[model samples]
Target: MEHPILFISIILEKLGLPVPHGFVGNGLLEQLCAPYMTYTWLVMVFLFVVSKMTLGNLEMVPGGGQNFWEILIGGLDDFFVENMGREMADALFPMLTTFALYIAVGNLIGLIPGFMSPTSNLNTTLALTIIVWVTHHVIGFRAHGFNYYKHFIGPMWWLIPLMLPIELISNVARLLSLSIRLFGNIMAKETLLGILFMLAGAFFAPLPIMMLGVLVSLVQAMVFVLLAVVYCAQAQEHAH
Candidate 1:
């Protein structure tokens, strides 16, 4: 079945706005802008609204929406500090948290009856991978100048001949791997659930798969966030 959200996302592109176009539309700018809509922008809007609504009022003890959001951000902040150090954590926390939340929401969006999870589309995932790749490598080169190339070449002059191509291939593979893994898993899960829903009219029968859907959603989010953390760390790594 053709996903309706994918179509709507395409129509948004037709108006010259940015939206993802996997199988929906075909335009250079549409392709370029699609990821922003499919994942990043959508996620950002959700996060912003949720955060503002949740934490609109600061409280000494916290309750309800404020408490929930505080716990979420606080937990994420702690994770970042443990992984990336206090200063870096403080600096990158917002971006990292935003990325995670976006991917998570994008993944789960498919679970809704009419909407499709944009992350399940290969183009969407690839676009996100490219964004991360560019951002981190740019930061690395900016910080370390020519030394950032060493990440691809490895340590020791002797290893360059053998390791350069290997490392280069690995880096490229990261994009493909990240994109495919997310696209395949989410798409497959949704497909299976879709089939089961069609086959079984009983509500409880599909509940298990829906539960799995939630798991896949969280896992995909974690994978994206984890990769982002690794990229950020590598970009900011001490130069050899």
Candidate 2:
């Protein structure tokens, strides 16, 4: 199938940069300008600008942007604290917040015309999953030192033979689960919207689906973060 031309691709092509006319090819330049990568960069820039605008000015009263950000951040902080005690929450808050914001924005960006969701790509989702997986394991090691390995061993010594492999397999499976779940949902959402747009032809018929897409995007982001929090919290727990 021919790839839909994105506004970014047009701009890049006009600027004399190489951009493949159809689907992303194997070339380095094509991969760099792939729809998902381009939109991902756009989402990152959008978030950066919004963050600066929201956080640049400080006021005693805290109206407008300050009030909005405080409420959002405070709510997220409280949610994390409730899930995993204060210390762990404090340690993981920034990373978790970044995950939530980035995933949420990336997922939602697909609903906009000429944009694609970064989370819809397996590479992007896998990258995020790997980061989360490594982070929790590192936290586990920090929290429990070498004893973190005890987590893989069962309560009794003999059970270690069976339990160790089981634990290892399950942990590894998390990598696949996290990445595939997000990628599948967002990709399906994007596909459905594309079909709807083709059928409806710029009409309001897709509005309902778009609204549901928003809910799906938020729910998926929350689900991903919630699972990450659970994994991190479990890692910090003392081994039986």
For candidate 1, the per-residue lDDT at 58 reads: 86
Residue 113, candidate 1: how far off, in angstroms?
Answer: 1.8
What lDDT would candidate 2 get against the real structure?
A: 0.90
Model 2 spans with C-alpha error above 4 angstroms: 20-25
Worst 10 residues of 1 by lDDT: 1-10
Which tens-of-lDDT digit does each residue in 65-181 have in candidate 2?
Answer: 989989989999999999999999998898999999999999998888888898998999999999999999999999999999999997999998999999999999999999999
Worst 10 residues of 2 by lDDT: 17-26
Model 1 ranges with Cα > 4 A deviation: 1-22, 26-45
